[model samples]
Target: MDSIQMFLANCNLSVSQAMRKIDSNSHGILFLVDDNNLLVGCVTDGDIRRYLLSGGGMSDVVARASNQKPKVARSLAEAIKLYHNRDYVVIPIINNQGIVIDMYMGEGVKDKKYSPLHLPVVINAGGKGTRLDPFTRVLPKPLIPVGDLPIIELIMQEYQSYSCDEFHIIVNYKRELMKAYFADNEANYNITWYDEEKPLGTGGGLSLLRGKLKSTFFFANCDALLTANYESMLKFHKDNGNVITMICAYKNINIPYGVVEMGENGVITDMKEKPLISFLTNTGIYIVEPEVIDDIGDEEAIGFPDIIEREKQKGKKVAVFPVSENDWMDMGQLPELEKMRKKLFGE
Candidate 1:
């Protein structure tokens, strides 16, 4: 099979099977073809998401979720024109028979337009980072190098892409190094540094700015880099009137090999060759309102999840914004450092 073949899916395939094709393409799109290899429809990344959110099952045929009418070009000239003139990132070139022959995937397209959010960002950089002990012994985890730039810098740059510049960083362990590193950097970031007098947990340090923040803000861990759109997250928070919106990603766990389920007396009940299970996990990034700060007791040590749970118990609106698994880069573990580097630089 050729490179473009990865982007083609059978119309009869299950939604999960089509999802695997979409993942392989890495462009969040699939061209659906019938048995005769003629394009029947298209499924973009958002299509499956909508299908799932609308109570559609993953085991159903993808034909049920695909757009029956998809944009296609019958000639090279038409394909180029469509690629440049519209927001569509990928366009399929098809012959008179509607068989896909070529593709215009990248380049010559307009840059992604992002509206200014102007939200404040708070980074919790205070932990001792015992997870990365040896490295944390040498340098703060926030300063740990993912590539040429430090992890903290990468986190800030992603937010900067959405026009969020104001930052509040809470620091404790090796704080002087964290402050000095940013102070001497030429980027000249506008930052307000908060010191934890004692070891305050993730949500505890946020209390330092209890009365200062007047609007919604972005809160994140220093080690997590999210490539998803920040503007969409903010819109969801405000549109749903949620006091807190936790950004999460679906993690797909694939179990290979035939597995059997047994009943009493070890009788075989059922079996499957392989299974793919997906679970949504927190990415440690959040859209938060200022009022949440006042809810935290000053200098109390509590993880952010616990704090959010407390607010939920009080009947506050806390929602979740889901993104795909590949959108998040976690630098907390030692093994993930190289993975994150390769992801950002494609080394």
Candidate 2:
């Protein structure tokens, strides 16, 4: 029996899907998928690198590697040698007719836990934050004190909990101060800086970061806060290969008075009192692919929603991941910040 069959119970992925797993992992050589407890196909590092070199997009299927024969090993030493020479991280022990009996993974597989890849988060912190009133007169929105810690740090900590450390923070106003703050209190993480000489509209600031960032990185309005599991979200993004993914929260509004729905013939067909309406408002968070950022115009203040519309015109894949109403928090307004403080630390 091969190790691939064992992983079938663990990963719950098809052979075709398992093969692509090597792309994200550096040490892994190949991934194995099973079909009804039977060996199906294998994926190798070479297969993924070739696909990228060919300019094959993320949406392109990696089904080609499924036809190749997997390297077999009888003992652990033989498997280790095969893994080292061929650079295959996982070797499946199989019998005739491609039946997976057992599987083996490289070292650290037992120690390191698996974290899901969903979306990379990019936080835009460049704005002057005129909406924040007196706070903007002194500190940047990211630097504003939420409770005991700065708001940006809290935001980063939230994403960090999900093992997302790849961050890109757009800086314009007080760029020096922001950089200094981060440098002084360095958190062992990777954060690429995007500086704007002049004010660039929310969408325009991202134009400079097109190629420097990952193919898909989430964009968040610095001042906004929300509670959600990033691991699950990124898994959804990869599974769908979405070009743009929005994290939305539902907002409910109550009508104070009765409302009537009238027909064209001046007849009131329906009447409801104090109706509670629900809407999926933008939560100021987005998971955007690199190709989408390429369309951003240079040195202008363009909004991301406009870019989304453009992608839609071109028939690109744009999606939304919704969160519960209580799980989301907006710090745009002063009162909202107070409410968030209480929610975060309790009154």
Candidate 3:
């Protein structure tokens, strides 16, 4: 931020105002101060999201969504220790008088993006990439360039950050080219390649590895990348006893016109100007148990969502792990490829 003021907000600000400030600060958080400039509480974009999801409106006062007991430091030295010990992005340094003095951004966790999760990952790269059209005619979707590296490589490197080095890639269209590119590359990826003789839709390829994966593994689509904390996701899946945990992203979309809701006979019960709709969209990423792979029926065409539904119907513990909207990136389309390029490489 240009100044520390961007991270500081008056405790009386509205939720929408705090949301905008947090967006501008790019830290997803803000420290709120009272009239006397005393630290009152802290609010984060996540707090606002939970509020909205729980039927709270954006026009509500931010204090209603604030965490009353926020973690703060008395000195920079203490802030640095707290910053590393806890994964806090920003910590406010306050005086004994309970007045806001300074803010500290520490150093340690900045260099290390992720800890070791040590899980195996399965990448579904079998699609024909028809959406990409002419480009798909030559190079496969997995080999499509996002920045300097292919999208699949970027996806793999993301998993590698958590020490999940083992990869199982299911390839169909242009399988030979996909294999050839990795065969000569020196990234030294421990990859097991699976071939689908007939085009099996998203989840069908798992049938090929029915007996292979013995433990928990990540299942991902090559066209999208997820930046959520892998360790936390794994813990949630295990603690919840979920056989499949589909990673979802909170997507916020704004309506251009006034949204109206009618109760009966042209009687408008509720109306809002330019309403923002929130949805938990699937990010095409999953943490799956061995049972899920074994449950794959046949060499039939089936999307992953259908598989999840089938498991849900069978009373299997299927769950969802949600991340912020910015954490997921999809490069399935030509237009989104540019967005992905800028997000990954700042081009």
Candidate 3 residue 70 C-alpha distance from true site, Å: 2.0
Residue 345, candidate 2: alpha-carbon lDDT? 93
Q: Report the C-alpha lDDT of model 3 over 216-323, residue by residue, as the tens digit.
A: 999999999987678878887998899999988766677899998998789999999998675678999999998887777778778899999999999999987766
- The superposed Cα distance between candidate 1 and the true structure at residue 2, in angstroms, equals 2.2
TM-score per candidate: 0.93, 0.64, 0.86
Top candidate (TM-score): 1
The count of residue-pair clashes in candidate 1 stands at 0
* Model with the higher lDDT, candidate 2 or 3: 3
Model 3, backbone clash pairs (residues 3+ apart or across chains), number: 0
Candidate 2 vs candidate 3: which has greater TM-score?
Answer: 3
lDDT (tens digit, per residue) of candidate 2 on 146-210: 88988888888777766777888889898888888888885755778888888877778888787
Candidate 1, run of 10 with poorest lDDT: 104-113
Best by lDDT: 1
- lDDT tens readout by residue for model 1, 1-347: 48669888889998777877787677788999999999999997578766876777767899999999999988878888997788776788888888999888756545667889999999999998889989999899999998799999999988888899999999999999999999899999989999998988888999999888999999999989998778877887899999999998767767887889999999999988887766678999999999999899989899999999999999999988877777888988988888999988988
Structure candidate 3, residue pairs in collision: none
Task: List where candidate 1 sits over 4 angstroms from the true fold.
Answer: 14-17, 57-60, 106-110
Can you rank all candidates by TM-score, best first?
1, 3, 2
